[model samples]
Target chain A: MSESFQRSAGRKVMSRSSAKELGAVSHLLVDAQQRQIAAVVIGRGKKAQLVEWAQLSGFGPDAVMVVDEGALQPPADDRERAAAEGRLELVGKRALSERGNELGKLDDVTFDADTGALEDLLIGDRRVHAGSLLGSGSYAAVLDESQEPSP
Target chain B: MRLLMTASQIRGLPVVTVQGGEDVAEVRDVIYSPEAGRLVGVTLNKRGFLAGRSREVLPAEAIHAVGQHAVMVLDESSLAAPEDAPDDVAHPAMERNVLGDDVLTEGGASLGKVADLVLLVGSSGEVVGYQIDKAGGGRGYIPLPAQLSVSGVALVVPNITEEFVQDDLVGLGAAVDEFRARLGLP
Candidate 1:
């Protein structure tokens, strides 16, 4: 089943071993080219933590299950740190076409619940396929304008 | 539709890095090469509180894309010190500015005074037209015609240019292709 980013926000993250809540879901960090969720950020700012998709034991509707509290890690690099800080969050970013025209603001993202593969980006009421994602930054998310390819 | 903007509008826009999504700097001035009809580089200002002119410059080649909201770069390292910048960028302060020069046709008819340059977005800073304060009335945009000469006093364009003056950037965008086709410019 596909899970919307809106539905996942604030979901509790629990440790499988102790079954204690580690943190709440902040947002998912995307690997644009791969069209997959790289990691899930929990909390925010300097105190933010991350759990790589590979480390997650299960992604349930109720809460995310990790192997243990040890699965949670501090941001590993500058890019990850920005993601953890919410500066690089995919939703709410202005979407610009590769040709530099503003499409709209991204409203939500849909991904596969089982594999964490990104499926689509919702820009207002428009659904953009995951394959069109080019790059994203603090200012805007760049997307391939799939409709009209310049000759 | 192609988005068009004046060079002056690009000033004060932030320069954001793609990987870390951090605003590294803001544009101070656009270093344009009117003779070449393209952007050469941009001087920068430091971002955030107490911000001021930055010593670093971003050469056009370092830019990933110039969008309406921000100028995108690969990373902060894409910026370079003035000494390491391209010749046009390093000494841009003294360059001859095109604004305020008279716009004249080859037939010697005075059209207007140059006001600004209109650039086509996403073509890597290609200058496509000129914004002018028309002699008899309001502002107008003209597709960049083949320049016969560019002197301190006047810019001489093809006589046929008078027929292509557009009312706005949107109109100028559509006129550019037709004007280029008429002039046999590739």
Candidate 2:
């Protein structure tokens, strides 16, 4: 397994060609062994674009480098279109209750810094505790104001 | 360890109006996973809407404040509970939603349900590609578009008509044949 590509989560990728330009890297494509970054998908512009690691010209504590638009691709594909569509669908999903009440749409999903697994789903106003429920056998419990101690 | 509150605790609280005394909704469900342990989604039960009808899932950032009584929302328009919400809210279309349902043409013709979704999984297992399931039953994958809304249930594709599926979807993923036959459909 390649080890050089192993990267810390939330690492910022800087543009080598453009010194000041930078993009937030949401995920990195590494080998199966979970090491060696084969490619990187930077979340920039209005979408997440895939760029080859070779295009990376530099790295830093706060950012990484790329060959200026060398890794860019024209946005036109049905599958890509559908995939983008799925992302939009996530915005309107109804946050419901066991009794089924309207809360809000999901805002973002946070992951563990080490394992890269799902951590918690951020809801509109409150954060639902989902740690126990995910993975192999754990289940989640629901809490409300009545359950919380008076702050 | 400092007493940390669980995401469930935050989800269950009733949502009262930030402006006054009106109770807007009750916390019905909290959607989260253990991997990240981060609260991602919330289900709210609107008081007036019928059972199962009033639920809405909002992003965690949309929350302006998490008070004792109610959790304030950033965008009120997002709170509107529509009877017919897109797939993302209803059910996760996953791989199954696309495989054979019939990809409609711009003019409204049968194309094919997604046979498989070719997702671009980074070294971190973060999904990057979202290949659509095509007819003729081949492993034709496509990159997932950036604009897509990946939320609770369905993959939301705007401008797409409704007359697509007969039943609601459960999850979305690549085609069954694409996998090595051991992992099965996720």
Candidate 3:
């Protein structure tokens, strides 16, 4: 979410303090509520690491800025790891309204590169804004008709 | 709308060679490393009339694109016997398939049954959440590393996790994000 990093995946990561190279960005952990990049999951399997956006000092064109190499921690915990699997899981899922209505296949979603805010969701033909983002669970992206995002 | 394919939806998907479109193989299993949180590789069943054991494998990198009906690859180069596959392509030791296993609260309250493993989009080798059948008679998902302990039989999660159960995919997806934030799962 730091000033909207457009392309996050595969970016090199360096610690400002130690001037040490950590690793490249493997995945962006987005916070749904905040609608921004919460952290970046780096490394692989057992060595996988996570660096929260707050720990980042800056977002450069060449590398992602971080405080120190120590900020990187293995994303070994079950919860954090679980979130990674679900992050990009939304696209193939279905979109449903509160009335149990079948909307359609969630086609795509746009996220702001500058603010890291999720902009809108393309569900089949209709577009749903982030404000309409009710839940992005394993089953579907549910919307609340009672609270529609203004055009 | 970023199209997402479920494990079940992608199974049986033909692995077609991009060059010739030759049906090199059919995807039989999608292997994911929960620890890595991305898809590691896949197992294939030879195109035969009979149901047989899994053999051929292609690491995630060999994939070109997973379409609505088929999984396309750059070429047949990725097709290799499981034994010859790179270390990352070899199926990890899955002494158990946690698919149908029951999930429980740390103290033994029933949470749900493991329905499916959710693979995030754009994640080449990571797994994100487990779609569970809640004891309340519906489905919900708990983000990975939800501070669960494996008891050889069931997954026991913290009691507070009950609040995170979601009925739909997007909600479940959001729950995982929120849950990770609460637990500070980094």
lDDT of 3 at B24: 63
Mind giving the per-residue lDDT tens digits that candidate 2 earns over B117-150?
A: 2221111112222334444544333323233443
**Fnat by candidate, in order:** 0.41, 0.00, 0.00
Tens digit per residue, CA lDDT, model 3, A1-151: 3332235567899989987888987766655545556677776566677888788887676887789988887665554675455443455566654323345777766665445577777776776776776554444555554432221
Ranked by TM-score, top first: 1, 3, 2
lDDT of 2 by residue, A84-124 (tens): 23321222334332211234544544433323334444566
Candidate 3 CAPRI classification by DockQ:
incorrect
Q: Candidate 1 chain A, which ten residues in sequence have the lowest lDDT sum?
A: A142-151
TM-score of each: 0.90, 0.24, 0.45
Please report, in order, the local distance difference test score of every candidate based on alpha carbons.
Answer: 0.83, 0.38, 0.63
Model 3 DockQ vs. reference: 0.01
Best by TM-score: 1
Candidate 1 regions exceeding 4 Å error are A147-151, B18-21, B93-95, B146-148
Worst 10 residues of 3 chain B by lDDT: B119-128
Q: Model 1, clash count?
A: 0
What DockQ, on C-alphas, does every prediction get?
A: 0.41, 0.01, 0.01
TM-score of 2: 0.24
Give residue A20's error in model 3 in angstroms.
Answer: 71
Q: How many Å off is the CA of A128 in candidate 1?
A: 1.0
- Candidate 3 clashes: the total is 50
Poorest 10 consecutive residues of model 2 chain B by lDDT? B119-128
